[model samples]
Target: MLTIGEFAQLTHLSVRTLRRYHDAGLLEPARVDQASGYRYYSAEQIPAAQVIHRLRELDVPLPDVQRILQTPDPGTRAGLVADHLQRLEDQLERTRAAVTSLQRLLRPEPATLDVELRAVPATTVAAVEATVELDDVLAWYSGAMAELDALVGTPGPPGGLYDNELFTTGRGRVLVHRPVTAPPRTGRVHPVTLPAVELAVTTHVGDHDTIDVTYGELGSWVVEHTLAVAGPVRETYLVGPRDDPDPTAWRTEIGWPVFRLAPG
Candidate 1:
C-alpha cells in the first residue's frame, strides 16, 4: 500500500485531486486509517487513476467518465469517446463555416450576383410534405428525401418548396419532391402540381451551411429591381451531398416567386 503522498507522486496526481475524486465517488483509496482519517491506495489502483485523468483532460463529463470506468468492456469505452469526438468535430465545422461566411459578408466591395428573371410552368412530381418547426427542418428534410428516393428512385434532380411563414413564424408547411414523369401513389409520396410563376433565380454553389447568405443577396436584388415576392421560395438541388461528397461541386438553385411592382 502507498500513502496518499506516495500514490500522488506515482500517479502524477495531486493529493487534493485524489481526495476530490474519492469524494465524487470516482476513485477510491484501497485502505484508510480509522484513527487519523488518512487515505492510502494500492499500486493496482494507479492505472485506473490515470484513465480518469485522461478522460477529464479531454473534457468528458464526470458522469460519462464514471460510466466509462465502471463498464469493463474496452470497446464500449472507445465507442463513447468516439461519439463525443464526433460531436466536437461537427461543432468545429460549423464554426469554420460561420467564419467563412462572415468574412465574405464583411468585405468592403462584394462581387455582384447574377440574378435572372424567368417564368416556370406548372409541373407534377413525387412529393412528401409536412408542417415543420424551424429547428426540425434538416432532420425532416433528410427523412422525406430518403423516403422519396426509396419510392421514386430519384428520376431527376430533387426540389423543395419552403413557405415564407416557416421563416417568419418559426413553424410552417414544407414540401420536398423529386422530379418524376409519373408521380408515385405509395406511402407519403403523392403527385403535387407546382403552380406557374415568375421567379428571380440565383444559384448557390457550396454546402448548405452558408446558403442563407445567398438568400439574403437574392432578396436584396428583388427589392432593388422593383419586384414584389408573390409565393413560396423554391430550391432545386442540382448537385448535393448525396450526389457528391465534395462541397465545392455542389449546386443549389434558389427561386423566389415575384411580380413587377407598378413603376412610381
Candidate 2:
C-alpha cells in the first residue's frame, strides 16, 4: 500500500484532487485508518487514477468519468470515450469556422465594394415562394431551386427575394425566381410579375458564410449615400453551385430596394 503522497507522485495528480476524487467516489483509496484519518492507496490504483486525470483534463464531466470507470465492458468504455472525443472534434471545427469568419471581418484591408444604383424593370418569372424558418432556408432553397431548374430547363440565372421579417422575426416569406421564356404552370411553379424597383447593389464573391460581411458593407454604403431602403432584399446568383462546384467561383449579387434622397 502507498500513502496518499506517494500515490500522488505516481499518478501526477494533486493531493487535493485525490481527496476530492475520493469524496466523489471516483477513486477511493485502498484503505483508510479509522483512528487517525489516513488514506492509503494500492499500487494497482495508479492506472485508474491516471485515466481519471486524463479524462478530466479533456473537460469530461465528473459524472461521465464515473460512468467510464464503473463500466465493466471494454467496448462500452471505449464507446463513451469516443462519443466525448467526437463532440470535442465538432466543437473544434465550429471554433475554427468562427475564427475564419472573424478574420474576414477584422482584416487589415477595408471592405471597399463598388455600389451601384439601378432601376430594374418589371418582369414575369416562374417562381416558388414560401414562408419558412430561417434555419430551414438552405435545404428549402436547394429543393425549390432544383424543382425550378427541372421545370424551367436552363432559364436565366436564379434569384431570390427575402422579406425583412426573415431577419427580424426569424420567420418570413422567401421567393426564388427564374426568368424563363414563359411561365410554366407546373406544380409549385407559377408565373408572377415582379414590379420594377430601384436598388443599391453590390456583389459578394465566395460562399454564403461570409456573405453577411458584404451585406453590412453594402448597407452602410447605402446609408452614407443617403438612400432609404424601400422593399424586400434581392439576391441574384450570377454564378452559383449550379454553375460551378467551387465556392470561390460563386458570384452573387445582393440588391436592396432603395430610393435616393434629394441633395441638400
- Per lDDT, the best of the predicted structures is 1
C-alpha TM-score for every candidate: 0.88, 0.68
Candidate 2 lDDT at 7 equals 92
For model 1, state the Cα shift of residue 108 in Å.
Answer: 2.4
Overlapping backbone residue pairs in candidate 1 total: 0
lDDT of each model, Cα atoms only? 0.93, 0.92
Give the per-residue lDDT digits (tens) of candidate 1, residues 4-40: 9999999899999999899988998999999999998
Q: Which candidate is the best by TM-score?
A: 1
Score residue 157 of candidate 2 by CA lDDT: 90
Q: Write the per-residue lDDT of candidate 2 for residues 1-264, one digit (tens) a residue.
A: 999999999899999999999999999999999998899999999889999999999999999999999999999999999999999998886677677679877889876789888899998999999999999999999999889989997768999999999998999999999998788998999998999999999999987877888898898899888899988999999998888999889999999999978888
lDDT of 1: 0.93
Q: Per model, how many backbone clashes are there?
A: 0, 0
